[model samples]
Target: MHPFALIVSEPIKIDIWSDIACPWCYIGKRNLEGGISSLGDDAPEVEITYHSFELAPDTPVDFEGSEVDFLAKHKGLPAERVHEMLDHVTGVAANAGLDYHFDTLQHTKTLKAHELLHFAKEQGRQLELAERLFRAYFTEGRHVGRIDELVELASEIGLDTGAAREALESGRFAPAVQADIAQAQAYGINGVPFFVIDGKYGVSGAQPREVFARALTQVADEKAA
Candidate 1:
């Protein structure tokens, strides 16, 4: 037995912070799913929660350009280099079963989208809405920042469109989004796709599935001891 082992049994809780506009955040989502899938019957009971983290909180709702131009200008990189980076990330995402269409992507503020996610969380559909928003932005090029579009997306996922519209219009979940951001700041997390396991272990970036699997296994083992 390990000398430092602590013994307790409980479902593992993973709080993930990410944004829809972040390409790696989408990849990280698939990787985490893959990791859980790899555990198969041996996996422990897990509760996964998604938190708000806007990569571009101050971006305009109606950004007037393609994603490539947005990135090139925002990051001060050459257009060619930005394209190259997008191409490489696209390839990686494709390998993870994600289709990224940077050419048609709409670059917009994600604060509203984050608030919508908080609403979905209250309705017990946060992860579903998160996935939908990610796909809407990266693959479908939908304007997730728009209230009408968000209401439509929520309806597609069987969430009450009227409720979602009211919430968005009233800015009900805005504080929840802000709370998540403040928590992230307290943790010193400045990047997207950050995962906190059981409120103790923090894993950053789009780590490999094996990394997640190992962390889960280790946490479970320590708790079981």
Candidate 2:
């Protein structure tokens, strides 16, 4: 064995702070995967952890409106402009192989959804749950803010349904969710789909595949040095 042979002390960690209801976050997730794919055979070992960052923490659990309505009212944009924004993003999501049914999306608060993700993290299925929740909220129009709906999502991912319900009911993982939010704030993150690569590099928004590929290659090279 060569004395100076390169060895990874740890997998390159990508901490992504995002919310389920954010369409761009879903697109960013796909773009990150595309970036990893761009690395091909030389891709570095990577570990991704999704952190909670609620886009609308103050939103009611049972918001009586469509996502477009919420966004239009919240941002004070004309309905036409909001629809245009959503249409542009929907097309972008399609390019990334996601079918975003914004018209059918059930807009609701994501606090309980974040808590469910924390619980899934404890059960070693955070990634699965994160993907499921994103798909559910954006594509399937499922009610993520409700306890019954969350339990169904948990069961769909092979988690213990009763346990998930209990966690939501008892607020068991609420602290963990809040901790993730605090950590994001400490990192000075102000948006979703923000990526922190290897704890030093920060990539914001749904960047191109080449961008993520370069970051991984650069980090891997530095580790070898």
Task: Give the count of colliding residue pairs in each prediction.
Answer: 0, 0
Q: What is the C-alpha lDDT of each candidate?
A: 0.92, 0.92
- Tens-place lDDT per residue, model 2, 1-225, is 789998546889999999998999999999999999988999989999999999888899989998889999999999999999999999999999999998998889999999999999889999999999999988998999999999999999999999999999999888888999999899888888899999999999998788999999999999878
Provide the lDDT at 107 for model 1: 90
Query: Model 1 reaches what TM-score against the true structure?
Result: 0.95
What TM-score would each prediction reach against the true structure? 0.95, 0.96
lDDT of 2: 0.92
Angstrom error of the Cα, residue 155, model 1: value is: 0.4
Which regions of candidate 2 are displaced past 4 Å? 1-8
